[model samples]
Target: MPILEDLKEYVERATGLRRPGKRKVSDLARARKPHAVRFKDDGLVPNHPRWPLIIYRGAFEFDERHDPAAVIEDLFEANGWGDTWRDGIYDYVHYHSRIHEVLGIARGKGRVRFGGKKGRIFTLKAGDVAVLPAGTGHQCLSADDDFLVVGAYPPAGTYDECTTIEDRPRALMPIPKVPPPRKDPVYGTSGPLSKLWKKAK
Candidate 1:
C-alpha cells in the first residue's frame, strides 16, 4: 500500500502544475524520424536502430501526498540508474533508438503510440507489461488518473542524454525518409541497425 500511495503522490505532484491546452498533431505533416543518442566510430548518428535495450521491472504503489519525482529518482537509483526530469508531462512523443524499454504499470491507465504512423496506439493498465522496441517513436496519451511506469534501458548509459522536446502539443513530427538498407554479398551484416534486423529476422 505504501508503494501505491507513494506512486499516487508522485503523479499528483507531477500533474499539479498548470495543464497546458491540448495541441493535436497537424494534418499536414513533414518527415522527421525519431532519434536517440548513440556512440559510433564516426560520431553519433541520429537515425540508427539500437535494439534489445533491456530493463528490469519493479513493484510500485501510489500515494496522494507523496513526492512522485523523488520516488521516481529513488526507484531509478535502487535499480542502478539515474533519473533526469524533463518537461513534466505524462504523455510525450519521443524515441530512444539505442535502447529497448520495458514498462511496468503500477496503477491507473494510459496509452503509448509507437512509430511515426498515426492511429497505432498501445494501451497500458495495472499489472500490464509492454516491451518497446528501439528506434520506434512513442508518446503517452490520456493519463486519466495517476499512473506509474518503470522503464528499463539497455547498453548502459544510453539514457544518460535523453532529449526532451517541448513546445509541440499533441502533434507528432513526420518520419523522415531514409535510404533503404543495403543488400549484397559485399556489404555483409554490420553496425547496430544490421544487428537488430538480423535478430528480428
Candidate 2:
C-alpha cells in the first residue's frame, strides 16, 4: 500500500496532475445558495424541496476532445454517474419523479425553463452543467440546431418522465430515499452535491 501511494504521488507529480487545493465552496457553485440553484416556480411542478438545481459552469472546457458529449460522458462516469446518453432537451415541459439527473451541455446554446410551466428560463451554452434533483421540471425553451446534452444518473437510479399529478405521490417518497451519490459528478465527494444532498431540513 505504501509503495502504491508513493508511486501514485510520483505519477501525479510527473504528469502535472495538480492536486485540488481544498474543499472550500467555490463561488461558481454558490450561485443561489451554498450549493443550490433555485429556479422560478412555475406552480405546476414543485422542485425538489431539499436539493435545488445545481449548475456548474464551464466544468468541461478547454479540452481536445472537441466534442462536449464525450467529455461529459467521461466526467459523469468518473464520478460514479452512469446510464449516460447523448441527446437534446425535450421541447415539451417534463420532470423526472424517481431519480435525479445531470445535464452537461456539450454543444450549441439554448434557453431552458425549469420548475414546470411557470419555471424560469436560462440560456445554457457548451461547457455548462446543470444537476437537477428528482421532481424538478425542465424543458428546452429554444436552441440552435446543433444543441446537444449528455445526461446521466447516479448508480442504482433510473429516470422516469413524470408530469401527471398522480406521479407526485410516488415521486416524493423515492427522492429522499434515493441514496446520496457517492460523489459529485464534477467535484467528487468534496463537491457541493455531496454537501447538499441528504442534508436534513
Candidate 3:
C-alpha cells in the first residue's frame, strides 16, 4: 500500500479515527530523533593526517528473521546505522555508551522498558516512531503480535565493541515470567513484576 494510506490505516486503528487529518508527516519525524548521518574521520590519514571528517549515510533492511549478529556487521559497515529484528517479543539489555535509536514501528504494539526501571506501554498501529536513548534496558512486553522496527545508531560501530551486555551471560535477562500490570493491586505498583505475582495469585 502507499505510505500515506498505510499510515492512515494505522492511525485509524490506533486512535479509532479520532482525527485522521490532524496527523502530519512531521509528527512521525518529531516522535523519533533524526538518524545521525555525519561522522568525524580523524584517525586514519596523515597531516591531512587527522583524516578529514566525512559524513556517510547508513541503511539496512529488517524483517522477522534478520539476525542481530548480521545487523551488527551492517552497522559497522555503515558506521553504525541499520535495521534490527527481534525474533519475538524480547528484551534488549542495557549498554554503557550512549546510543541514539530512532525506530519506526512497522507492526504491533507493546511496552518499551528503559532505564532498568521505567517503562511505557505504547500501542503502535504502523508507522509510529519511538526514540530511545542509551544506557536503557529495552524490551517489548505484553506484545501479542509480531513487529518490525528500523533502528539507527551513530558513528558506525558494533554493539560488541561498545556494550557489555554481550559479554555477560545474564546481561540481557530473559523475559520476566509475568505480564504487565493493569491496575494497582494490594501487593505493589502496577508493573510487570506485580502482574506476574498477581498471575500466581
**C-alpha lDDT (0 to 100) for residue 56 of candidate 1:** 21
RMSD of 1: 15.7
lDDT per residue as tens, model 1, 104-151: 564566776544334256565654434444444556877645665545
Q: Which digits, one per residue and each the tens of the lDDT, describe model 2 over residues 98-190? A: 788899887789999878876678898987888888778999989988787878998756778877777666676675566667888876777
Model 1, residue 184: distance off in Å is: 32
The runs of at least 3 residues in candidate 1 whose Cα sits more than 4 Å from the true structure, single-residue gaps closed, are: 1-90, 155-157, 160-198
The sequence of per-residue lDDT tens digits that candidate 3 reaches over residues 31-113 is: 12222211121121000111111111122233344332233223222332343432333455343232334344445555654
Worst 10-residue lDDT window, candidate 2: 21-30
Give, for candidate 1, the lowest lDDT window spanning 10 residues. Answer: 20-29
For each candidate, what is the lDDT?
A: 0.38, 0.69, 0.32
| Candidate ordering by lDDT (highest first) | 2, 1, 3
Candidate achieving higher TM-score, 2 or 3? 2
- Show where candidate 2 strays beyond 4 Å: 1-35, 39-43
Which residue runs does candidate 3 get wrong by more than 4 Å?
A: 1-80, 83-89, 96-98, 118-121, 161-201
